[model samples]
Target: MAEMFSMLGTWNWLVLGLLLMGLELLAPGVFLFWLGLAALLVGLLSFALSLSWQLQILMFALFAVAAVPLWRRVARRNSGASQSNPFLNKRSDALVGRVFTLEKPIVDGAGTVRIDDTIWRVAGPDAPAGSRVRIVRADGASLTVAAD
Candidate 1:
């Protein structure tokens, strides 16, 4: 293992960097990009001044660690520029804060509300059919509602 480290040259570092970056295309978790950049920086540093294989690896590790904070800061600053839809996959959440008539009578704190063509299970006070109810929140597949 020590000999392998000693034999790693500047070209080896560059190749390793390219290979790590290529892996990013395969498994895109946004992590390998930082490691790839680290290897590339080490290669450049080695080109300027001859460095031992161990030193090159140390520089790569340092650079990779340093890049994480920079990436997080960039993501934090840009997060508000275009807000992502938090309710994209949550269908029940979209029903909250809307008033809908009870399709079925609410007996024993259970009922159903018809929103358009879809019938959704709801939990609230007992009420007769056609009574107006306001959706307060959603719990999994059920909506929590109250009298509007």
Candidate 2:
């Protein structure tokens, strides 16, 4: 093992990099790709300057660890620029504060309202049909409303 490491050359690093990168395809995580990149960088540098096996290993470790935060910073920057839908899969919560006319009269603190073709059950003070009410809270399919 010691002899093999001592005999490490530019081609060895490049091959190791390629092998690691290929393994990334099998185990689909973004980890091995960075180590592969580190190995490739050391291999490229080895062409210009002969590096001891220990120095090459150190450089590879440094590059691999450094890549994590660098990648995260770039990923965070790109993510911040993208628009995310907060209301995705949460249809009822999106209606909070929106005013809609009651389709059925509220008696005994229960009523129904039609909003965009969907009739929603509401709870609030008694109100006659056609009266406007604002959605104050949402709990699952039920809405708490107030006269608008």
Candidate 3:
């Protein structure tokens, strides 16, 4: 292993980088890709400067660590720009502003509404049963409503 490290060349780093990147396709968690990127950087750098194998390994380690913060910044920026759906897993949030009829009368600011075979607890001003109400807000399993 020491001899191998001592004999490290640009091609070796490049091949190792490519192999790591290829492995990422088989067992991916966005980890190996960074290491691959670091190796690739070291390989490319070796073309311009003569670095010892130990220095190359050190540069690879530095690049790999640096990639984490870079990746986080890029990911955060991209994620904020466009989101697929704001209400993907939050079903209650999607119900806001939708109008539904109250199945039970809202007495003392409490009532129940049935929406798509699911009974939802509602809180709002007193209203009679069968009255149409618009969802003003959703808090977990409870919804705040207003007479529509």
Please write out the lDDT profile of model 3 over residues 1-148, one tens digit for every residue.
Answer: 9898999999988998999999999999888999999999999999889999999999999999999998888889888755677787799999999999999999999999999989999999999999999999999999999989
Number of backbone-clashing residue pairs for each candidate, in the order shown? 0, 0, 0
Candidate 2 clash pair list = none
* lDDT, model 2: 0.93
Clashing pairs in 3: none
Query: On residues 19-49, what C-alpha lDDT tens digit does candidate 1 reach at each position?
Result: 9999999999989988998999999899999
C-alpha displacement of 108 in model 1, angstroms?
Answer: 3.7
Residues 1-148, model 2: lDDT tens digits: 9887899889999999999999999997878998899999999999999899989888988999999998799789877654476777798999999999999999999999998989999999999999999999999999999999
TM-score of each: 0.60, 0.56, 0.60
Question: Which candidate model has the greater lDDT, 1 or 3?
Answer: 3
Lowest lDDT 10-residue stretch of candidate 2? 79-88
Residue ranges of candidate 1 with Cα displaced over 4 Å: 1-3, 18-32, 44-55, 78-94, 115-118, 128-131
Position 25, candidate 1: lDDT: 98
Model 3 score (lDDT): 0.95
